[model samples]
Target: MSHTFSLSRVARLVGVPRSTLQRMVKEGRLTAQNGEVEMEELLRVFPDVKWEDDGEYARVEEIKKKAFAKRIFERALPDKEVLADRLFDLTHEYATAKGLLAHYEQLFEWVMHKLDDVAEAGGAPAAQAVADCKLWLRQQLAAAPREAERARGLLAEERAMRIVSVQVKVLPSGHEFFVEGSDTILEAALRAGIPLNYGCSNGNCGECRARLVAGEVKKVHPHDYVLKEADKAQGAFLMCSYTAVSDIVIEAAVAGAQDIPHQVIATRVKAVELLDERLAALHLTTPRSQRLRFLAGQRVRLKADGVEGEYYLASCPCEDRHLELHVRRDNRPFARRVFDGLRKEDPVTVEGPEGSLVINLDSRRPVIFVAWDDGFAPIKSLVQHAMSLELAEHMHLYWVAADLGHYQDNLCRSWADALDNFTYVPLWVDGGAPEVAARILDDHPDLSHTDLYAAGPAQFLQHLRDGAMARGLSPRGWHAEVLA
Candidate 1:
């Protein structure tokens, strides 16, 4: 048996920054005694446990790494998302028996023994790692009648012949859907395209709130952000807030669905060789068989296999068949792949043409598009699409890049020649352009009334929003993309 450690020691076992580990304690995100936290509590949050001195932890991690490599080598899966990695991570944390840590460890271990080697636990693939966890769980499960039935019910072998229907409704949109999972609604929704809006979907964000119209639901995780007495009276609930004790009908206010276009398809890519290193100007084609319809400046989700992530569309109606995706390699999961390993003809999927980040072309006053770096993707598509309709003329794009060579000459020179009304301004953000926005305001003092389409990091996007708002621009008149 191993000795329990303090919060500081457990924090080291988990990769969370010390500050966040501390917050988890203060916020009661995890339970602790005095200044000490169980290694097991830490494990429940993070599955891949590492002991400061235990050889077992390293051995398990190395084994997981090898399994991951083998999966990728066989092309069975792509890279894991930052959050998804955390799922399997929890499978490795262990606690001493009979303590608060016992149940978490036992439950995790029981799950490991009954599944295949390639199965995903919760949501991440950690079948082999989970298998190692079964020993202790099996013994305790035999003594706990109720939980034993619940755990066994989740496995196919445990109940392969049974089938059930589950209904779900998307909030705000009210777009209703259905699914059948071996376990919970959260798992089912993820399998379906609709993910419940959540931060730490473990019920921390209060972001996953929904209405439980009828039937029963149980809180699986200890969520203190319970529905207020008033809201609960009205039938609203948090999807991650509960597990259905009985078939449940609930409503959750889903995010990410405003003015989002329909049927976004993506294919093809163009390598902007002159752009920054590992930077590629991907010429994304809508479904090759059909034309993808989206606003010039909206975004879409890029999916490869079962894993999906999002990107903005850089093409417009005029460029109907061809879309553009400006991708840069910065070591983010699926994104890094598109920039580095993915190529033309590689099959990919696209979801809702999303986001409301575009100029109201009807405003019609030689609009200005301000973008930084790859943020130019949607702007280029919008400009191209708008010029074709004459709804846009005398359009000016002011872009800030690391340097001048970051842009392709054909893309620039062609816009100048083809659309006499279209203009381009490229600034070097790194070469001491004190403030690109300030430079633009200085050059075009008439900035007082120019309609702008801005997209970039939260800081840059907010900078434009604040400056424009401060200059007396109505909030509706100035548009910026919401990336967070």
Candidate 2:
């Protein structure tokens, strides 16, 4: 055995509490065998301790050290429940019989052999060998029956698996969804039609970030994104890579809207209403068996006559089996067909309703909408949907077009006249001037509390976003749909 001192003795010599030495051991700053601290470890930890050469002190230290060592030896072994007391006593008796008290490894090996023999006799050699080492010791002890019972209890506990379905409550919207032990929160939410924001389904992107407002979740996979310590402290977790461990309440970054689920269906053009010389409202009728279900402000990919393009659904989803797509003449093949060649009864394949530009119908904040030209298609869908939802909040629309005629001023004026919560502002701009953006900023000087939605050309959206941020609106408070 190595020359060692009791931890209490080392602490007494070093003029510190025994708990301090224990703490160092726990922290891996120092090592201890049971309650005994090695002399070399003591010297390594504290080289500054004053040593006394007095005979009386040396005699007392030696006596205390022997007793402490004996006590540690007794306590160092595993409990009788796991390695029964009878086996411990038998080991001692065998060691005494063979005069091999110092040969602990030999005695331990013998005990293991006996356990293997008993396990083999049970006709389960393979299982016995793996679980034998500890059980063998228990079998040699007098409390073998009790120890075996305890072992069974521990084995069952370890074998038990947690596979319960957990309830996940989303904040702000109070939307509840279930996440099975196998599925992630994001996957479950998406399946449940809870529009949670997500970029990469794989954990690399941090787009699915949410706060664990209450309860626990376990990371199901490694993420390429490095989560900040501050964010972790605030209970932030990537929803794509985490599964709920218990019933949880999470505050997701995205809002939850009770909109219809998305669908892909075949439809025929009911009529082509030319609202203006440049704008064609193509009304498509879905088969009664499969009507497209979509939220307002969401776009659908329409494939017709060898051309496939995305267009926003202009009519409210309440108008089942009927779809209205506002197509403007941009000289694109799809636009040309809609304005000139496309006729009634033409077959149209509508796919999707993707995009997360829907309203936070629950938010009580005032809403501001900015749309330019044909971008008003989705904005019109949104306004009508909001009115249908009876959103009791104030709403303002700022429609910008090249001229008064292109602004769709009549439709906006009608809404303004009918809805008490709606306001309309028609802005005429040539090629999106900086003054038009400045005028919007001038109108809403403090946009801090407003939920602003902007849909236009990329440059126009960027300008409005930059101007709004500079004016006081948070980036989180700004939502955009850039028409390319």
Candidate 3:
């Protein structure tokens, strides 16, 4: 029997993005049956993939670590109990395969004995036929197939992946992520940039309650919220408390912009990084027990020293407990405080993550991001979010700066350098908004199959939208936010 792997698992085993596999399938370069690839087919498709050397996999992991701004311990193993359960499952599968092989061997011996009996009863012709059959069987059994070596390597690599990290597929939303190390399902989901609804991440409010649809889960944390008997029978468990022992499917709610509640978190300033004279990046750390939950490209109200202002988030939500915002050197109270005297450990309150401009998580099409001046803040967040999800086929960033002068030029360049599918083009606003829009839109003649997110002044957005629409961009493909 041939083994099969899910598309996501195959991506991991072959050290490529899932989007690459999907593209191959679409282009008819690869065959997938019901979203699974057979081992032979996978080997045939990626003949040159070196299973023993995980260089590509390591590179991807490093990119994800930097993109999400989360520290990933490469050597961290799964929880002890989960590891034991996985080993037990693997052992059971091994035993079953061994038993089947033994049964096949016995059947082969019996057939040989029956053939001998027929040869003795019949004559010289029957004996010769039996001898030929026996020789063929022995020859086949003695010979190793051409794919044997590669198959062994592939299996070994996949087995290691299974023991180290298990994939979790959330129902309804179809979001998938891998639970690595000692991370619970919720932790893994959040780390992957999937906004699953949860309050009190330590399992107190039961807001993260979900039902297991398949596979097994082990409780790694105690929860104060008690489930009713009926609910328990239906496999109800808090996502915050359980870790997956195998590839799992669970029904859970994925939060949208409207679904997330308004939160007021008292965060402490971690640093005030001045990118230039005009712009500063305020780094804040939320309380351990009260992490702020907001989608990428959202704006939040920041309050410090009895003054508050609304600014777009400059950081991805996958960065647990850490939040980043860009403040321009204006007369705004919050911006003034940020540039003048914001110090480490100073209390700053964050509230109302208020904005609808966010990443379209479901889209797998190429994405184009346009930002004007400090609008790069929210655009940066969305880009990092898309990177963490690994859903975009390609990402193009066009930064049009007037006074700020591409403040984070090195970061943008790093993204383009590290990722094959990322492109960065910085433009100067010498000829006004329309000219900048023209320069950006000139590169993308056909926006029919792309999703474009732009943040800038109202005039720039209007000019860009008109040009994008003229170039076959759909109305639904356009997402814009006006920033002064």
Candidate 4:
């Protein structure tokens, strides 16, 4: 027999939010039917969710049924082997036996006192024996949280202890969190509704690296050179595996970002030019009344149906009446929206100019503009903005693109020549491979110490970040116009 089920049911079966499931659908990451999400898909995220098709609410009912079954089976068919194995792991990991022993004692107590309730005829004695062991194990388990501190001479310490809450100034996109029973800062932030920079929670991957500003913490678990002791002293540490005994403040710089004021304004696709079979230059125009004050390199999101994106603006900001974006012809079902369904004069909606790629008209800092691929958007903006401010000579530009031809038909060169003080360096990632950075460095090592600006996809921007950091560049001296 076969059955069909709704993904809504599947989402309910798991403890995750519906937004996560919806995102999966939008990204085409997880396959689902109109009213049917497969059991296999549900189990991928939660190994415990099961099916109960006896009713219309199959997955929901299934979750309750499964959890009930789990409780029942745990009591009925208690696994001494699994318990013993867990005991071994806990004993190896922690110096104290109380935690592991408490669980063991609980099981032991349940087995001896409640054996008859769980047993089937002759099984009563065996279950009772397990419970007896639990009572004996209880002797080894530590006292409760309240009592244990007294035994450790902490009761007197608590009498003198004063609790002070201080507000640490977290960055506009940074946050804080604490580790209980320990003073080690964790590798991830504790924001309620945001994704922290985390990779492996096992302390092996250093994905949640950040810097501490106030408060102190100690390491709880071992880390694999994710952060050196010296680095920690220098305000760098991992958040994933660290425990914060104190209310320490840390900053990831890009985390905890909040959405700013935004609105979708009517914009028209003004022109579309075929640079090549694989590339396109798209121009969009807003009504003269609705002037889009976007930077040359800033992008506005275009939404159709429900899909929206951070498409870079190719037109200089000086032309506030019109906007332009250059899109690579990615051969995908979604890509067809722009490459096929989209027309030169099609009505489009745009919402943004929300980024840090604009001209800092007040800053006297020299700018080193680096654009990888379609990242040329912001550099062009910076160039034009510099021209407007008559600070063009202070602006330096480097364009690194995957396809050199993409820059050919876009009329990018004419803008480059017209924009004073905007020097262009066009190099493909593969054309001059290994020495790309080296040659550029040789030509301009001043990037080693300048206000560097880079814009591109997450990976490209990350690469630039890593390279710049390796070359003794300070974070304050570096800026990025990243789109992900």
Highest-scoring model, TM-score = 3
Where is model 1 poorest over a 10-residue stretch in terms of lDDT? 70-79
TM for every model, in the order presented, reads 0.42, 0.47, 0.95, 0.42
Cα-lDDT of candidate 2: 0.67
105-156: candidate 2 lDDT, tens digit per residue: 6787787777667766777766556475676565676465643454343323
As a TM-score, model 3 comes out at 0.95
Q: List the global CA lDDT of all models.
A: 0.53, 0.67, 0.89, 0.52
After the best TM-score superposition of candidate 2, give how far the Cα of residue 322 lies from its true spot, in angstroms.
Answer: 1.9
**Can you tell me which runs of candidate 3 are displaced by over 4 Å?**
69-75
The digit string of per-residue lDDT tens for model 1 on 1-484 reads: 3234444234324433233444566667877775556544544565443323334333433432331221111112212331233233333322322455678777665656455444554445465455555545566665776533433332222112112333454444443333333334664454333434554456666766777777655554567775678887887666654545433457664434442336645555433232557566566555534655456677777787555667776654434255566666666666667655676577677777767775463454557777777777777656654443334335777777752243554565456544445677877775343366666666555555567787666766666666666665666667777543
| Whole-model lDDT, model 3 | 0.89
Give a tens-digit lDDT track for model 4, residues 456-475.
66666666666666766678
Give the total clashing residue pairs for model 1. Answer: 17
Deviation from native of the Cα of residue 76 in model 4, angstroms: 90
Residues 77-142, candidate 3, lDDT per residue (tens digit)? 888988999999999988998999999999999998998999998899999998998999889888
lDDT: which candidate is best? 3
**Candidate achieving higher lDDT, 1 or 4:** 1
Model 1: residue 213 alpha-carbon error in angstroms: 47
* lDDT (C-alpha) at residue 380 in model 2: 77
TM-score: model 2 vs. ground truth: 0.47
